[model samples]
Target chain A: MKMAILVIAMLVFANQTLFEQLKEKCELSKNEYLIVIFQTPGNCVKCFIEPMDLVELIKKNSLGINYKLMALVSVEREIELKVFQKENDWKHYMLVDDGNARKDLGAKGIAMMIILDSRGKIMAEFLPNQYDKNIEKAKKFVKSR
Target chain B: MKIILITFVTLTLISSNCTMKTQHILEYKPEKLQTQNLNKINIEPKGIIEIEEDENNIIQQITSVAIIGESNTLALINGKDLLFYDNTTGKFIKKIEATFEMTDLVAKSGRKPYIDSNYERRKVEVPYISTTNYTQNGIDGEIAQQFIKNFFMSLKNINNTFYSFGTIYCYYIGSSEKSIDNIPVLFVLNDELNIESYVVMDLNKNSHAIAYDFYINNYIYLSAPGMYKVPAFGGEFDSYPTAAKYDLEGNFIKSVSHMTNNYLLKGGLKNGWVYPRFIEVNNHIMIVYPEELAVFGENKKLFDLQNLPFKNDSGFVYYQDYLRYCRSKEMRPDIDVIARLFPIKIIDAFENENKFYPIILVWDKNKPMGFYYLIQEYTSDGKLLREVALDDEPENQIRQFAFNKYDKELVLFKKSKTSWTAEKWSLR
Candidate 1:
């Protein structure tokens, strides 16, 4: 009984550590599977299309998992932000981030995605200039989990 | 110095003798070897060399060249002047002065005059009751017009043949008002650079005709788009894209013609026009809608894309991915809708043997670096064999090319820095 309790406590502590790390970097608190897409003002339009599609696909499938999705946009102007929102149809979860967020997040370029665990721990990240490859990687990551 | 000169002279004598035909050179060689050791003697034979004098200097002002007929005679164009040269010897032959004016034929096939606000054809008064503000600019319109008259324009070449056609614009002084007419004339030249015929095509007055190709059966393919609703005196006609088959002499062949059967207009959209050129493969005449679609044969069947991995889906995926990545990029929504339906533009297509080589351009959906072409090879049954990306630059211009059917050789004529080069390659 003591051994079993010790193993469970260790697992919980590891999960908490992962959650803390993800929260520190992504500001995601839902402690579930979260996909945060980073977009820059000068990013290619082709970059954001796949993430939007993945969001739609996940929603349609009703995957029984805690998922928090948000787009970190560099543009500050409300009108410009709305235009970007309207263009991408990002009505639900959109966060305005500092322009240096891409550099801070270690993102190679725009259209980069950071996948986080339920405990706010980084699971996997995909950074392909091509959105097709990025979406394929995201789909495969979800399937593997 | 004398001994060295003698040795040089002896070597020249030996080389000249060896270069002669076997019958002429036999006299200089002994019938049998006098020495027993044949290994000690080294025999060298100078091979036959055919020399062709370079004629590029003479044709410095030449604009284009077309290798015609079985003899491969070159038909060179310099403005309104057409010069002929022997393809192998590079010898200049003769130059012919030509004029492209279709005015006489267009006036003869006249239409009804304009009346009221409606576009109804009605008889109008030939003479005006009063004349005022009459102004004349030299012989034609102005000095600018005179300079424009001398400008030369060449249209697409007839497929697999050296023949090409051009439109001739002519103006006539009517009883009351002046009128302009467009006439299409065919230039048929043979192997000797002799002008076989300069026949004016007997087509409709309001319709514009573009000659696509002249086939083996003497059938000429022409794109006469939106010709059914003929225009009246520079009036805009709704495009009803259509291609027709005519004889070598440009007479409409109803039996095999795509125009008579409504092949070009069969596409659901009425305004979806096609480029003038057509490729003949596997006995079928094929025309590409360039990145959008390809239609061929008498039935106008769509070429199957069974071999392409993603096929149509790949194009949409690219657009969606591109549009999402660049948040600031702006594009008309209608273009997105069209792209969702049809994603590619077929740029240039050629045929080698039974295989088809299509060059396609896929847009990046954003400005700056907008487009790139994908050169692909496919079988007649539409099996994709190979694909490569061709980056486009402003300086590198692909002017013209010819393909050898038997050897599978492609000779691409590229123009750069006011000079042209013929590059030959074998298709893998």
Candidate 2:
């Protein structure tokens, strides 16, 4: 009886660890905001925003904002995401979603940025720009909090 | 280090499944090979016009032949150059050059010219009109020139122009620099080579530059793949093979989404890959692709292999690997069985009292000579009323053949393997 109880306890602990691993890998936490960057699959060069711009924006504010950047890579392409990350120096997480990602996020064009709050509710969206206008709005929201 | 390892694991998991799916679709084995017997006919040789031999030892040839016009006038195009054969025997004619590189030619029978201003504003720095005057038997050239001019101008006024009972139009997507500002312009040119109208299609979303192709009846199809931002091993984000349709005046008629919900709902949206070959058959507009067929109608199918009957050809199976490899290398395969298999290669169509007949010329891969099997009045039930074997000799190949509606005869254009001269044939 004691041995069976011990095995059951270990199994439950293992399951908990697996759940934690998934949450860590996906960075899915109530405190973190999920920013989805949507794009069309091919011949969409101009729609893409430089990763450096995003990184600079995040670093400059010192607002203690927690967020994750996800790139919705289309399935049609045989893209190597690691190679993409290394070459572009994209330090954020990326996800592979095909056309569904566009429909789900209500994104009609490429290089669209949507900000989801900690509760997974959409807070705001930004189009193709330097985010000068968006940055001020985000600062106000952070200050209000 | 742990984060890097996690990223590596995630990428490997994602990429492996994609590779597997792609391979599964492309790597199917063929059952067997089949051959069909074709007819052969010899065309009389005319004098050589030009010839050049490639390293592969294959000869490139061009020729001009005379047609029995009112005064021995013939129409022919040689290696992108248009020439006319006007003589006593209707044998040899002089070369006629036009201002623009001729994309297509339509002969207007006894039609007069008319002008329109709708085309004037959209005309770029290039000349809006390109025409020439030619006449036989010492007839005045002024009448012919005016007739051609008025025909093009009047055609510009027609909202929908039909060519040989089929509507035709051209659509253009402006350059990337202009598209970003929502000023992307699309030009619609009708069958009579007149600018029908223009429209500015805006990319409402933050999009990559606009890239598109046209469907029959003026459908502007757009395909922008999402992989552009991702830094991958490939050179650039090649355009996807997605499509949509527009009206003659560049109005967005309908947009086609590439995805559908299945039981598992597993697949992603399709991308536009190649220039779409649009054809109107049985009043149905069908867009042909190597892997998929897009039929416009109530019953829509997705990635359905059975809809593409030409894929069953054994010759296609034989060349499948080489073609796929060439496609991977960004090269076009020479023998496109899909395009050639369908009746799309039919050069001309004519209607009799009770039936519509299509004159089709098909390529036979097994034959040593590049002969084309000419079928007169080819029925959809696979019946050939008249079979003419064209280009039997190994030294000569039939480049193109068409029915001269004006002359009421079959016109065969033949070129020699070693010479530039092309021979003309008229079968009564």
> Residue by residue across A5-109, what tens digits does model 2's lDDT show?
999988876665322332455778878776666543321234554333453465466377776667655433224343344323566666555445544554433
Candidate 2 lDDT over B50-156, as tens digits, reads 32322322222222222333333444433222344442243343432322212112111111111223334232321112123223223234432212211010011
Model 1 alpha-carbon drift over 4 Å, by segment: A1-145, B1-161, B172-175, B205-207, B212-216, B227-239, B253-273, B305-343, B362-373, B385-395, B404-407
Question: All candidates' TM-scores?
Answer: 0.44, 0.33
Residue B325's C-alpha lDDT in candidate 2? 47
Q: Clash number for model 2?
A: 32
Two-chain DockQ for model 1: 0.01
Candidate 2 chain B lDDT trough over 10 residues, lowest sum: B149-158
Instruction: Report lDDT (Cα) of residue B345, candidate 2.
Output: 41
Residue B421 displacement in candidate 1 (angstroms): 1.8
Q: Candidate 2: which stretches are off by over 4 Å? A: A1-145, B1-71, B86-91, B100-394, B405-408, B417-428
Q: Please state the CAPRI-style docking class of candidate 2.
A: incorrect
| Positional deviation of residue B314's Cα in model 2 after best superposition, in angstroms | 13
